[model samples]
Target: MIGETFVLKGNDSNNLIKENVSNLKVYSIDSVRVKHFFTEKVDYIIEGNKLRRTKNSKIPNFDEHVVVYNDDGTFTFNSFPRNPPLTIPFQLYADYDFSDFDSIYGNLDKSFLSEKLKNKIAKREKIKIGVIGTSITAGAHTLEQFYHNSDKDSYPYLIKKAIEKLYRNEVVITNYSQNGSSIDYLGDVFPTALKDNNDLMFIEFGMNDHIYSWWKSNLPNFELTMSNSVDRFKTHGIDVIMVGFFQQNQSWDLEFINSTIEYNQSLSNVSKKYNCYFADVNKEFSKYSQPKINQDFCGDFMHHPTSFGHLLYYKTIIPAFLKEDVNDGFIYNLVN
Candidate 1:
């Protein structure tokens, strides 16, 4: 299906679609359900409001990718002929479909995370969390809702919201995040991340860490500085959770992954070194998104997540408070 031609869906029941979405520019950080779309290289014609592919096109088919929407307001694995149903977050003409947003937060090992939450629940104490990271954690590109709290959609704030919602405990957060900065610099802002004797510290500085490739050649273990920061937090009796971010690239054609994932691995090692939680949002993002539009969670077609993206972050996070009796090992993941 790589070189196969296709058509955009209209009133027809089939899922083929290709309209002049030229008017529908897609840097939308505000849409919900049908998550967001990045792009691809292709040519098409809009005839009778149902666009179809020309002689040769590169837009992958439902078989290759999984986001082909049918006219019946239901989408599946795209190639599935109703034997099974599926949903994805690719908004078309505001036909938002959040019916299956939870599918991405696949199975996460919650043992370490749940252990931390048990102490909080048993004591019913107020939770203080410290956040340090790049623009994404600082609420970049995501517009705050009118008549709502500012930066409420950001993960730090959402983390607080999720904790209170699930545990009924008071929560306080100190977010000292700087935009356009990587973990190398942003992780060093001291006194701020150390204030209030934080119960938990969330380190989120991997998106802007493209400097690691050169830093690797010029420096020691690239994550050394971040590991130091985590050590300091741990020294102060602060629990650390190295939050991982998803990358914009989906192709693993080469053995080389992007810097964020590189940092994710580094941070994963750091988490293992300290025995703490490493919330793998990167894996969650990969599970829900299409390859061609891998950066769909990112609003700027880069690294910042939309409000919905932030919500995904929250949902993926809150399961840390898993009930001991809950049989399933995952949160928000559905049986396929």
Candidate 2:
């Protein structure tokens, strides 16, 4: 039995002693009594606490000891330990309907799109758009986790839907994105995929390139990668819309930050060099903080945006695709 005021003591081969004795009134056992108790099964009772065996009764070892806490405001144990505390930052977002954007953009003038470009898009038996990038661009968890429907929630899907509604379902979209891909991978695969002409294609890939060490080492190559991809597609008389993706963790390494800026600058340069449409998705998204919008809008805090986030992307890119002047003032109002 284990109880208040009673302490157990034991020693190793060196005859050293470790005791759990207290000053309070309790039964006392001498060294001989302790030795006899260990040698034989004597029912020693302890008040106010239960006794727990430290080892098998038939093969008990003195080194294996039990821990006992007394009602006298003290605890005795063979092990020494302490608990550590942890703290972390918490972020959340608000919920709002994003479908209103369809109507807003739908009401805009068709003059935004040049007559020649509009005619080419309208003449297509099946209007086509291509998407290329990393995991988020591939629509990972964007549809199932947030939108609940794969076809209705992805940014690419939303863009396709908006195009269909505007053109009365005359559009076809092809998504050729994959997880963990960079500009190098896209440069290799995009040419064959879009050998046939497309009305427009959206390109996003800075997240992977910025974070991976290999991509950081070959940062200068990003410019060539962007130039080749855009030039290859434009050769077929297809229009290109290059997007600069946003990154969530701003406190990441400076190298990553520099690379992201470099890649986005490269994207802008390429878009200009080839006279293609360019959207600064990263800059547009940075306008609103985590408190202003829901976290679901930006999934995994790394890549992918929620439906509302997608709406943000659409709001930013659609105007550019239509050739509308998207200065900071106009974009600021659209996001708010």
Candidate 3:
């Protein structure tokens, strides 16, 4: 491995990179190849536990751009920034190998989307997308207080941006996802969400749907509601993509984690029964989560995941539309 990586939660008010970065031998720092690819010593000096930026360096300041970073044990800086600048400094790898994403997509059911995506790309038709879920699906992030791009950086928008880039289809997203909502809440807006006539729909609800105290009893209702919602869309001729949501650090209780796993199974069952697209991102999240020494995608250490988390969400969902040999360097171009 090149070196251990980490993400700082955010930048300090002064020129300091907060968090004890003294232990992390950070060789590179950047956000979406747009801002400074900072070099240590040359860019800033490490004073005690904090890394400070040089006064005159080209490195983006909080005013010009968002300071962010993420990896393992390093500061929890995650998510790539967008123009107008968003997210903090992320430790980006110019030579990152996306081959690992192959395994992330390996468990997905692609039989339903290949034809759909190919047809859309061939005709060059416009795509309308609808996403319904709880906060995580709604693009809830800690950076929203400072930046407004978190919504644009969510998995829903990420998937929308990716399809537009790869298929050349003009994609428009109508995200009805809200924070703290349950499967029952989606039931309330089912009428309006279905009216969009979307070419694709991304549904994520396992997190909020889970009844922490009575998860066992709620499984049936969760499955029923999700199935009903998906059925309504499918019946209306809309293609749907569903994934199992996983919590990082927030709920590690054996029973709680088990409830989430059961919820994932419910999602799998529904997707299989409806013949819709499904990706088990819970597996992918595990591949990078802690005990392996990497920053968790969820920046809050709870609900809202940073851009890196959303990136994982996008990679897992888009494979259903991609082909066996379509992997490329240009595959990821999500900046809208």
Candidate 4:
């Protein structure tokens, strides 16, 4: 059962989209059943809003299947039509798609960060950047094939590279992030991570905390734990940057739980109470998700951001990391 795929119904198929291939037609469908298979690609053909594949296509012959929606709300796959309805769970190793935004959203509370970490980056000093939290900070869904390179694709590494480029400094990045870990487990990992003297530390754990703790009605304990973590890091002169993120799951029983938006507000409260910086990456991504323009920001619909989504993450925090005012319409391409 560990390596099995199950149907997650009444969910958005946007995040499952492999990528937009120009030659393929687009369709819309409900429900997504996913499994991971080691195939180079997946194929499908669009008939109205339905998807089916042929035998000649390059997608592997797995017993599972995953249907994805493109950025423009269309469906695409590389293979031809395959008959016989698939009952077993399947994996889809799809292509690359970027989330697009016409404008930036959210405000970066940089007042504290400017007085603390910006100067260190500007002077090219040896700054140690520490990051802690879940798979998002650990660089999930960051495949090199889709992005330019490893350094440019990941959020932590990108922030490291961006600082070096902007400040020409000798910077070091210490990632204390563990995949699928949350704030409740922070105490377990904190002592070991605290051994290092990090100039600035980023705390990112809303996704998992919401999935686990928020659903358990443990909101008070979750906030207290987060606050304590911030206080602990601050005691070491490690400036903190709290990250609020975007999620793409439709099957998570969102109506009954405290919303990610509200969770982000709680994070903002923590940042304010602790005099730390807050980067509301979720607010920016929500611009598209709200209107249903593009939903592929979270490549896997849990926490992993695509390459473009990663840019949105770093970009929101970049202004706070710098001393001078950054242009609002700025765009970052890793290749340059």
Candidate 5:
């Protein structure tokens, strides 16, 4: 395999092909294809960890791009000067088989979604799923619009597809999440969020809610807002599921890490009080609390997940949608 690794200076727009190479195939993290077939010279722009593309391109803003290197200095992107730049490492590979990545175990726990709702999906009926919360739900690492169906790999998108595939149903999943959103902010956006009558609603705010400068100092307010959201959505006859947020060891300061753990506990309490399904991905990562393992699953050091991490989120809730066991695998019984 021809492999290239480089550091992308944030906010810089540059051509990746400094010299010339033959038959280049570029891919992003998680072995997601960036350029499947490239015979001509190619270039890229970066902002933070995101890759900037043309207006009509489907590529996302960041995750790390991969490419083959024939440049004089080995694998590297020829970046131009930026007003300010943040140095970020990237990797590119030719004919990568993903043999070196860690194996992902399918472990979906019991779901708390109502039986009636479960039956509807199991029968391949039509359903609408609405998701609200933060950047994670907004397709952070999945890189919305990058590929025609890249977003399908995100948790919400995967949940919809898994239900359809397992139950033979048609599912419509809507994402109303914004980057850097918190519980209180989500509450403020309630009117727009509730405009659609969703069969199932996924709430993800733990990452933002745990921010010390944001919700941690105002813990009571955070709890009240999230509680109100659960009540309001349930009142609207929508089956509510609270997404337990995901984070890694190196993602935050010790203080913020403590707050994140506390916030997840509070989410568990809220789920019990409201009798909702808590898709606790945070708890899943508790086993991987060590920095090495956390980085293995998470794409960024924080909430942005690699494809495997996203799969765990999908597992967190999709099984609950199934009426009976598929009998195809043992991951069906992973209970937390």
Candidate 6:
């Protein structure tokens, strides 16, 4: 039994009177015979198949007690009813569609990279590339989560490996990236990293910049930070490759969208100003509208991408480093 008693309050003119009996008195009524109770102006009406009660003052007041019985063991009151049960089915298709924005943005072409590597081999003693960014460059996922495997899966690792494979010789790659870092923080850090000679360096910083609202509006300051960082590396005879990383979940809120566009535009301006190589991963990742596909590209819903996604990054980034056309190779064929 549902262990509780609900009190009904009202006058007795139309309450508890069996038939049309006026001024009748009744101690209790069977709960099974009645469905619900309601107040009719100054009196209470006991509702069932038909209205049986008429004018009668026999209904008890608030202090009085009455007992009712029902075999069904269900209860009801004038208030709202309880909610029905719910069931949720598991979805296997989730996270199936995530894609690496780097691939989409870089518009990679492998044959072009091969040709560029051949060109570099012909022109230079050794191709030296420097990579600078946040945790992604530090090889967080490749070294930490996927440790036992080959580093060839990570974008940077893959880039380095691809270069080495093409050249069949030592490709010096200095990685100067820290976790939870920003462009402003790189001013001091990059100088030391580029102290050694570097031919190309990839720079990524939008992830940390997006977290700080103040930096978004201060475009001049952000530009200065990038300029200072790049100038330091260039002074050391290093060619700079600027990359703008994309957030997972292709959906960008207004604030992030605006900030990202602004930041990438600023980066592009700087790249052109200095004749530096640049890759726009944010624009590339925007192609996939589905979040599941986007997640597949990214590690979680942010930061880095999965192995396949990293491969896409490799496909996109390698071409830019080599200054090759992005529409003429296995990379172009695969992405299309």
The better candidate by TM-score, 3 or 4, is 3
Q: Tens-digit lDDT track for model 5 on 114-151?
A: 66676676566899888887877776654332234345
Residue-wise C-alpha lDDT for candidate 6, range 1-336, written one tens digit per residue: 000111223332211111222322222222132212233323335442112223453333432322122354322211122111000000000111112212222322332223444466656457777677887666554323344433444566666665555445467777777777877777766657666666667787766676544755777887888987787776666666787776543232312446767777888888777766667676555654434333334433334555445554565466654434433233423322
For model 3, state the Cα shift of residue 310 in Å: 0.4
What would the per-residue lDDT of candidate 1 be over residues 1-336, giving only the tens digit for each residue?
000112232222222122222332222223332333324224344432244333453322233223334475433222235212121222222121122112333222444544454587557788888787778777764545321435666877866764566568898888777777776664467676665677787888666564433634423445788778888877777777787887653332211255556667887888888887777787767754443233334444345676556655665555555453232213322210
Q: What is the TM-score of each candidate against the true structure?
A: 0.61, 0.58, 0.69, 0.64, 0.64, 0.57
Candidate 6, 88: how far from true, in Å? 23
In model 6, what is the error at residue 42, expressed in angstroms? 70
Model 3 C-alpha lDDT per residue in residues 131-190, reported as the tens digit of each score? 888878767752332155457767777676776776688989898887788888868777
Compare candidates 1 and 4 on TM-score and give the better one. 4
Indicate the TM-score of model 2.
0.58
Which candidate number would show the highest lDDT if scored against the true structure?
3
TM-score of 5: 0.64
**Candidate 4 per-residue lDDT over residues 1-336, each given as its tens digit:** 011111222222223222222233222211332323322123454332223444454433432344455565434332244212232212232322234323433333446764456566556679887888887777765444223324345577777776677668877888778877877877876676677778888888877766543454766677889999989878877788888877545433332235676678888999999987788887776655431212234444444665556666877776565555444333353213
After superposing candidate 3, which stretches have Cα over 4 Å from the reference?
A: 1-5, 8-38, 41-110, 114-118, 142-146, 250-255, 291-295, 328-330, 333-336
Error of 3 at 140 (Å): 1.1
Assess each prediction's global lDDT (C-alpha) against the native: 0.53, 0.50, 0.59, 0.56, 0.57, 0.49
Clashes of each: 9, 4, 22, 13, 11, 13
Task: In angstroms, give how far residue 115 of model 4 lies from its true place.
Answer: 4.1
Ranking of all predicted structures according to TM-score, beginning with the best and ending with the worst: 3, 4, 5, 1, 2, 6
Model 2, residue 9: what's the lDDT? Answer: 21
